[model samples]
Target chain A: MSINKDTVKYTAALGRIELSEKEIEHFTGQLDKILDYVHKLKKVDVSKLAPTSHVLEMKNVYRDDKVKPSLPVDEVMKNAPARERNLFKVGKIIE
Target chain B: MELNRLSAHELMGLLDKGDISHVDICNSIIDSIDKKDKSLNAIVNFDKGKVLERANAQKGLPVFIKDNICVKDELTTCSSNILKGFRPPYNATVIEKLLNRNAILMGKTNMDEFAFGSSTETSCYGTTKNPWDLERIPGGSSGGSAACVAADEAIWALGSDTGGSVRQPAGLCGVVGLKPTYGRVSRYGLIAFASSLDQIGTLTKDTEDAAILLKIISGHDPMDSTSVDRPVPDYAKLIKKDIKGLKLGIPKEYFIEGMDKEVKQSVLDAIKKLESLGAACENISLPHTEYAVAVYYLVATAEASSNLARFDGVQYGLRSSQAKGVIDMHKKTRGEGFGDEAKRRIILGAFALSSGYYDAYYLRALKVRTLIKKDFEDAFKKYDAIITPTSPTPAFKIGEKTEDPLTMYLCDIFTISANLAGIPGVSMPCGFTKSNLPVGLQILGKAFDEETILRIAYNYEQGTEWSKRKPGI
Candidate 1:
């Protein structure tokens, strides 16, 4: 499918990334080229096929409900940009 | 003999025999890096005092690891700017395993940002040059690991392969790199690129070093749900057996017309050598081979888009002071934090998985992935292993394919199929191009059948001088 500046804006939004006008123009061209290439897969007849999400058989992995020690608060908060009284502080989630 | 020049296993032997102390080995390696790394940039960060302290233990053996794998209190950046200055509080399972073995955690090596590129050029820290020729690109995102091993900067290194990140670089740098079966090595601490396709592997000076390192690191971990529960075999012992009469499949599609003439000839010569050594080579077909790269980008980028969401400037990594709201914070942080290639992947992945296009792109790619795996299964019914060129060509000059995203993606052509099939594969030095660039002969095996692949690589390595010649850098 053909991609444009609008496509880059939408993708950047969905990806939680902000881009400048220049990046949008640049990605508009790059994404258009890549999508065209990846579209090559459309020709394969997969009508009777089932999608393989993972290479291995994955099942619900269960473990005994036990308390495992967690990383100490000091170390856990080591990289937090904003924090307070043993909690990570962030911009307000609610309006 | 140069102390840094010895393989990991050789160092182990010397340590056992009391011929040298770990301190002496550690110093030799540290000095080699001090001398060589300024030009090579194989290692990104290291503190000699801490590394030397760790090396003082009787069993302490220095290992330079890819920056993507967590080593407690060390920066596990995946060579991305987002993770700049961020050190993990805990060790990945493999790191713990190595620490227990007294593996000296020397330092972290460089890689493509978030393991996104075939060449090390995408690293925020800068490209790691090939040891053989300083001007040529080192095949990556495991470039740093392979280059360091080739230059003898460290005994060996661990590199995670999603799409030939391990094997391709191993081939170009003239080192031994093994992309073990998907679940053989736990991914607990490996920062994800493509979860299902990603595997932590070994890069070393030779095939035996790969085997020994694999033995020390391979096993199940309750921490990693995807880790296989099967008993770990004695890989060191398994590679000792003769490879005579073993059947090897040569997929005709891999030697595509117009591929680099020199690279194709190198692999063809390798096939002849294996035949002379009594290993049977047969022509085989994996009909869906061409679609592997297309399928891999869909699956890998989609997984990467999801995995990298954790870096949203919420808890760790770079945050934006410009953000006025929580959503703005995430957007600005990722925008500023990630490199260009990473942003491109996130955008493509987000587009592929978007509501309207999911089935046409992501879903169809998954089905094609199944077909690719089926090819291996069908071939293995007759052949014991498969062989091909690890990369279509030897190391290209730095920035050669960076301008075109599609061209860069093509670098992983022969290697991506193994990851899609969840099989074990390795690239060993087969021969050199007339221009002196190293070419890798890839050997692939069925899931959890690394022993066979390792055996073929070992047999080929022992019989050839390709892996023996050191990079003159």
Candidate 2:
């Protein structure tokens, strides 16, 4: 149940966050505590139980697939930190 | 009139009678915000000209919306740096309803970044101090909404409740906060947290105000697939004071060892008052109550991990200047946009939902969630409503539990069960702790039966003096 420093670093990388060494140490302890507490779930006899993802029983309630008016491209792009020619500008995707 | 003190219903009445113009209400609110918000930090954004224009032709009442909800041209940050300047082009269904009713949009209230924390302390703008005590934390991620109402900054405010974000802070700050059934209010404009558990609700000064606000906003919306199609009830007509034959269940599980003794006594006294008013009280067992905190973190964080993934820099929000490519842009933007608690939850949630760990964490927590819901259903079948202390204690000092995630998660134990069951619940002031902090009593009812819960809360509030006590702030 112990999460080593390397695992913590890997997880933080996957989550796109940079953690300080102190934070990694602190999180390792905190995550261990949480995982230890959640370990109690393993004792429960849920073999016959179905995993319930949503409390409500309804599913697939969808709207009609119809085109509707959308905001003007200029209005949508008004808040973008960087943009060019009506497109949101981001760093190039591939080298 | 000082805009802060009037309840939404009172303001609406004044507007309907032409006694106060919408322009006047909007101006008064803006003036009040300019004067009082320096210390409270409750409001994150204000659009005075637009608000005045929207208020000019119709009624004279102003409304506050949580920052997470989209309001056409207004900023919708969810109090996170990631979407710092983002303005959603479309109005959410709830906003549409409010505009249709001639309610003026005053501004957006602050919250925990991405609605990730219980205390508003985690907000990117800064913490919203509890109006009652300057140094204490306001209950959050709807802390600003609750604090604003408590301070009379706005007549009424809209807040999203995902794991008691609205109700818990309302309890701590001494305001009326309701977490409607999951689909009771439309989610079309609410920034998603845990989607299945998120619902837009109201935080106001009294039950009557909450009733009127709920009436205006509750209904089906074609844009939100999960919005329930149930007929909206006449909430005002259902506000009867009759609790004579009602059965109220006191969940034995909620009175845990670490609970503040004053809060426990306050809850007991509230129950006694309910008894004197002719309601019967009984001790009930929700055996799975002990597992609520663990179950909540697992499910809420798992969903949050997925919902927040959509915030990568390319879509909308603050993008990092250090990016050399799209992947770098996504990584740097997320790293810089999210606050610490949000990053922690996303990482923890990602771990929980990972391929190898799904069965032990996500799936198992789902089974436990069912048991928690079953406990409430079984109790409701035997009683009319369930009562518990909204929080184990009242408002803590701003930095008290920031370092301890488990302790912070435990703060929502009593409130999370109702969310797990998709039931309606409310938190109202019952008494004050020895330190003068407010304690709240939670009244939980069956799904879609908000009237019963509100009735019980209103009756209790009427019989007590706690709701009348305000923070000197």
- Estimated TM-score per prediction? 0.99, 0.96
Best by TM-score: 1
Model 2 C-alpha lDDT per residue in residues B1-473, reported as the tens digit of each score: 57567777777787678777767777777777777788999999986777777777666467899999999878899999888878898899999999898777888999998888889988989999999888999988899999988987888899998889889999999999998998889999888999878999899899888888899999988878888899998876686667888999998899999899999999999999999988999998999887877888889989998898888877678778887888777777887888778888887888888777888899899998888888888998999999999999899999999989888888888888888778999999999987888888899999999999998888887788887787776
lDDT of 2 by residue, A37-94 (tens): 7787777788888776887778787666889997788887777777889888777776
Q: State residue B35's C-alpha deviation in candidate 2, in Å.
A: 3.2
Error of 2 at B463 (Å): 2.1
Cα lDDT for residue B183, model 1? 92
Candidate 2 backbone clash number: 2
Give the local distance difference test score of model 2. 0.86
CAPRI accuracy category, model 2: medium
Candidate 2 stretches with Cα past 4 Å from truth are A18-22, A84-86, B1-3, B16-18
Which ranges in model 1 have alpha carbons more than 4 Å from their true place? none
iRMS, all models: 1.0, 1.6
lDDT of 1 by residue, A1-95 (tens): 47889978998999999999999998889888888888889889999898888878769888889999999999989988788978878897888
Listed for each candidate, the true contacts retained, as a fraction, are: 0.77, 0.60
